[model samples]
Target: MNGRSPRWTVGGPDLDLADPHFYTDPRHHGIWRAARDAHPVAWTESARTGGFWSVTTHAEGSAVLRNPQVFVSGLGMRLGADPRGVEAAAGRMLVVSDGAAHRRLRSAHQSWFNGRAVAALLPVLRRQVDARLGELLARGGPFDAVAELAEWMPTWVLFEMMDIPGPDRDELAGIMARAFDDADESAAGAAGRTAAHTEIFAYFAGLLDDRRDCPGRDIVSSLATAEAHGRPFTDDEVLLNCDGLMNGGLETTPHAVSGALLALARRPDAWRLLKQDPGLLDTAVEEVLRWTSPALHAMRTAAEDTTLGGARIRRGDRVVVWLPSCNHDERVFPDPDAFEIGRRPNPHLGFGGGPHYCVGSTLARAEVRCLLEALLRHVKSIEVTGDAPRRPSNFLRGLQRLEVELVPEAGNGRGAGADGEEDVHVHEAHEHVRATGDAAGDAA
Candidate 1:
């Protein structure tokens, strides 16, 4: 065993926690292997929060999520150098509250994401997917998929479904992005992060009050008028719920859409296979979840001291679970690094596992299915034209600018193909709705 960490180290797990090597570089290999083999549960200090434990194996990690009585989500910096500070700043937000409290908080809006509600959203999602693909074509040729297509696509759909005031939609989205970055960048030990989150909550509070007095048909209206715990939600619940929806759906769905497009750019044959056989769509989505493993990691704090994979963790210590590492674990998956459509028992933690599984996973899936299904209909090939700028923060693994050509096969469809093309335009709207910065903060 490697003895205690040096006093000078940035963070534990014996790696450069500050630079984000885990996500952007191959250096993640040994660090993860070490964590998997011996140090499944470990502790480390961060500049912002002092220190926390790092959880890397599937069984042990799943244990933490399943037993919320023992661990709470949203303690913050699940995989960074700043646990003490982030945890200190945690508001016991929905993502952090455990057990009964989590139940009470989540109950405020869980029904809105139930299967019935999600199934009702399919038509709208498909239409939006169809329209957006057409819009990309109409706008014609070469386009930045990440910005023009990937970044705004799902957020726009979410805005419409949430019945967010279309006028204030863009600004609200920016606020959500700022809040997300705040949590992500806390490793830099910035005090402004808390203030930003507060600002986001205040704006959401005002928005919730407006929805109550002038309820409309959107999600805001639903939360305002709907009964929860025998009456309309309390003010805190209402505001936090909207904030949750915004934070939950904002960058996630978009990343899923774009991450797949990214995998395709590098693996043309996969796209070719999908275009020839659309039945692979379902498998393709799973493949994307496995290969990209969005959401990076989820953090949980020990309710009491525990041993994981033989590693002893102290009570109240923070443990970070690496979703991408688990997804790529050779122990659970064969060729874990390769993307394949027919991967069975995929069992990915992409949306997380156990009770806290992403509430909008079904919605996110349908949205991606429609988007990819539509993307294939429009573009024939996709290729990266230049060095893509990765997102600003380390937690999200995506490109800020994915320059590509959309070459439309003349007889195939009246649109552009995936590789690289410029000049075309098409647009449409969705009928239903539902559900990032930095490179160094990605996954291991």
Candidate 2:
């Protein structure tokens, strides 16, 4: 059950996990398998930003992620991150903070993402999935699902939840997209990223100020009015966390959705299983999250000297956990490469682990489940039409473009319920899904 295919040969010295190009190559998966087998906690030398240790196994990754005290996030959470920028974001941003500060910051946003809160959002999410998918199906032509369908629902939901003005959404989303662009690391790319961050900071600053005087139910207003560690969050703290929330909310779901669709197109059998048994939506959603592992890796710095997976460590050492690799670990998941919708005891860390586990996880699962539900009710079949280009980044494994034709169901008449209300099926399977506790992790 190691899932080690015959094609995966051991990578030689030229293998560099830090390179973005390394991920896009088809050989990357095999390389990871080879690395995991050879050295689960091997030290990787990166020409771009010195070197770091790569933790590839599920057990080791969970250990590092859960023990944030030892593998602190204050230094940086990704490769090649500027030290100055990481220092600035350390305590203010939830993703990079540690201990009490992390807990307090996470608390401010917890209520909004709790099960009850996510349940309230189900209607809105269903409507969004229906409207957008309805339009695409009506068009009756091949389309890039990434642009047309995958990206819209999550973007719309995040903006709506934040109460961001309709007019400003497109511009803000563009900026946010650019802010996290790891595809190109050239000088121009760096400049574009910096510019995007600047715009995002400014946008949130204005929103925070407005909410300070006149608060509302939106996240901004909550953060604006809330206090942490005996004092109200300063403008910088609110602004930083706002940036983090925006990134977290918008980044993970779309990639997961698109990846799910691509997986379905490739494995029609899985789609058929869902269509036959609508109750399988919960487990299918879990399978999607496990398969995608969108946030490729998350980094932490050693707070003090430590030993992990028999590797020697020192304080301030950088440790990167490859999430997708961990998800594919043979020890954790039997038949790791196979896409099994009915996978039980699936403890994949697609959402990450420990203190920084995704606050938006409940909402994330609901979003994916609703989309899949909509597809099952409406789409008859999915076929890949053209090239599906993956986003080139060392951090995110997302589709830049996914060209596919969605075949509509017969006699469904736009897939609306007979009563014309949202035709979502509520099943006991959700309890199991919730129990699995799989989540979409932080944007870092």
Candidate 3:
């Protein structure tokens, strides 16, 4: 309120929520903090995406997410110029759909993605973690954690759940890494985006054809044979929904894991506490989720005129809720900036809330827990080798590369990754950016 202090007035130069640069830069927090104190719900205009409301506080954002009837998700969860074809096509996916259609599609695989299912897969997931760690340890030096370790769990688990063949895992993961990138500001990024989507659709379509008659217990089989409203899913429905799962499965977990590792490397006290008391892993996981809040924001369209945080939201207006800001909301989180490992009652919006809450949250949490457990068991200390490169996207707070050197625990024997072979196979870092700067927005 002070005229002397710098104000981030909405619709001015300080308010460009859709810009990728806003996310990449660190100064946005001061602006958001100011927004929370002054304008809880602020309006802004973008030349690229037109005009929309920016909801900065936790209470208003949560209310928006909860009251889906008012703040809808059907128009595609991004704030930019309307890509009619893409929005129309993406609407069939659960994240972009609303009401009965969203519920129906979500219910098809709801049981499989629940807490119980994730708990049951713990042993298998542990083995997967151990195997990946073994490979990482085989190489006797520093490695990019984003490429070598953090990125391993999600896609592998997704392929396993979907019963994708071992041979196809790497290729499919590559396609997925390419498909969701909307941060590339280059001309080639645009062409690659289309090509990547085409390949992904064709791959899933072929899998659907193969599994149509001889349906197995895989997710593809379940979807291939699922019937909603007494009718089977059309081919387009199946493909897009499959792609939706792939998109969800591909991005969030890695971001969390990499971010968690970065947090650990920085905060030695929390890292030591976890090492000394592994029982604190769950609490540590929650703190990590809160700190990372990887998926930055979710865009909702107003279905009806409503008043929120003392501002009138007109029907059909876009409401972009910043999750990172909500996670750092001072009202809910005391000392919101510190990375305290054992913070309790930490109900962070990292996974979001309401009907459109992340369906794969259970799996994501399990993966992070497993990753932390593996780190605590195997590594004594981890140090950052270089600056972490972030993916150039506004939506996903993802790391492109994270270089870390692991110090193995004393008395722990080395695994196959200890082999000092001249040539070792490691998954290199991937850079995916969409040319148009849409950032591949999601409901989560």
Best-first order by lDDT:
2, 3, 1
Off by over 4 Å in 3: 1-15, 186-188, 413-444
Question: Candidate 2: where is the Cα deviation over 4 Å?
Answer: 1-10, 413-444
Candidate 1, 168-218: lDDT as tens digits:
877777766666663345444355555556777787777777888887656
For model 2, what is the C-alpha lDDT against the true structure? 0.81
**TM, every model:** 0.83, 0.91, 0.89
Which whole-number lDDT from 0 to 100 does residue 368 have in model 1? 75
lDDT of each: 0.64, 0.81, 0.78
Write candidate 2's Cα lDDT for 199-238 as tens digits: 9999988888788888866778777887766778888988
Screening candidate 2 with a backbone cut-off below 3 angstroms (N, C-alpha, C), the clashing residue pairs are: none
**TM-score: which candidate is best?**
2
Per-residue lDDT value at 255 in model 1: 76
Winner by lDDT between candidate 2 and candidate 1: 2
Candidate 3 lDDT tens digits, 139-252: 658899998788888877788678788799999888888877878756797678778988999999999999997986667877788886677887888898888888888888
State model 3's lDDT. Answer: 0.78
Compare candidates 1 and 3 on TM-score and give the better one: 3
